[model samples]
Target: MSIRTNVINLTEFRNARTGPPKRSEPESGLMLGKGLTDQTMIDLIKKFSNPVSERDYRNRALLNLMYLTALRAKEIVSLKFSDLFLAPSGETLISYTKKGGKLAFAVIAEETLFFIREYHSTFEGDHAYFFLSLPRGNQKERSNLSTRGLQLIVNSWNVKTCSNKLIHPHSLRHTAASKLMDLAGSIAVQKLLNHSSPNTSSLFYTKPYFNASKFISWE
Candidate 1:
């Protein structure tokens, strides 16, 4: 015999839990960061290029994937080799856990896939995680890259590029979303970002499409 507990009350309990918001300011509107442009991204990638070490390849691939896939830093760090799949259409399908513990998939571009393949080729043996931490000191344990480590990677790139605004890993996500929203429609960006709320994606990522100046013509 087994006893069953209803979890609906647990939802009510969790919903009552509240604390300070993560950010001091709002995530969208005027508070949002001035995301990187395509040219800036290109320049940053060039700066990261170094043929001597395999780490450079990994860095390039990591940054490119963030920009192309619009994946969160946590999602990227949590990625395992098993989560990646090659579709019959030649697209890379990346499975990741979203904020709500929901499983989501993002399609990787061919260019991004090329870098990922290049990075993967350098690794020997079957690794549990897609990205591993660099060997440090006597620490022989190989583990996945931490979220802080990934942030530091992005910060190092930002400093090297001498970017006016501080660019972090999430900035890459914003860049991808903003750029895609501009080129494609809100629906496209919403789907790529795996946003549960289409309004949030559209209102935040997609800039005002129509020119306000056009509404008022000089007579």
Candidate 2:
């Protein structure tokens, strides 16, 4: 039997605020916190997602995919080309074994698809994984990009801009959820974030700073 609690921890926020976490900070200011604010997330997409150079293409695609799908950090790194296909509804979707070996689905955004196609068009070599590490001196190795590597790339986006919040990759997931909650409430957010229950989704939205708006529609 699964036990569930739908309580919000008001005091937990105060406790968390008492001290800086005893750990490494964001490599490039990826922007994690109570949650990244909505406008800041939009600003991030606009600033970094250029898809110009090989590295640009990869980072741009990665950022857009992270925001669009709201997949977990490990799940994002675990994606393969074979996982994506056209759904009967004519929407592009990815099907894969999730945690606990459960089958799952996530819809891809059109902007994400465009960025991915640009990435593929510019990428140097093929790999089993969809995204690869552009290791110096030997780019074609097509090594599986580790979750830490993905974290660095994502955090790097805000390095130049700088932020008060210490950003993490999961910040993208929360940013997506905050936006989704404003647009579709907790149930829709539960679907996007793959929470076991809508209450979990609501809990995330209840975070003090997660006042997001609209949905994933970037121009």
Candidate 3:
């Protein structure tokens, strides 16, 4: 279950507080929480893979692309062939609708491009959707994966990989935002994530600043 779900019982907590929740001071000498490294992400991709056939491979590719692009699962499910473009510098561009139906573009890795090509060639469905669903009994159509289906895929992979970290499809979006903040600082992350306000961006970018007084000498 998500930590957000366990925060408070909405029915019991009716009163709104004027002040924000209190935060604890960080330990003077503890290592900070680390974001998932690129190597760690690569391992996660491999861990989610199945040896049985190419179907799992396609799913993994979709997951990777979603993470790499920092796209919401709905945006991913809504993607089409025309939404992808190859830049002159060999980068793959993933274009999709943002909040408010605004157009946004994210640069994808070369491997994601290759996998997308493979999926397109291997897919047997006539649907215009990028990620085609496996036919269900009496469904008689290839449909786009639902948001719930995307969550199930993430949950299943998390279980199979023995990763207890509460990683949802949205976690990838958070992961990308966190990494961007770590790499380029808050301003850049704010722009990339398309946050309307710096305050909103700060929620993801700001961390507990560690302080130690032992090193200082008073004159």
Estimate, for each residue in 88-133, the C-alpha lDDT of model 1 and write its tens digit: 8877787889978988888867777787677767755567666777
Cα-based lDDT at residue 95, candidate 2:
82
Single out the weakest 10-residue window by summed lDDT for candidate 1.
Answer: 24-33
The alpha-carbon deviation from the true structure for residue 215 of candidate 3, after best TM-score superposition, in angstroms, is 13
Name the candidate that leads on lDDT.
Answer: 1
The candidate with the higher TM-score, 1 or 3, is 1
Candidate 2 structure quality by residue, lDDT tens digits, 144-177: 8889998888777763222356667777787777
The better candidate by lDDT, 1 or 3, is 1
Q: Tell me model 2's lDDT, rounded to 2 decimals.
A: 0.73
* RMSD of every prediction: 13.4, 12.4, 11.0
* Reference-based lDDT, each prediction: 0.75, 0.73, 0.66
Candidate 2: clashing pairs of residues: 30-167, 31-167, 32-166, 32-167
| 89 Cα displacement, candidate 2 (Å) | 1.2
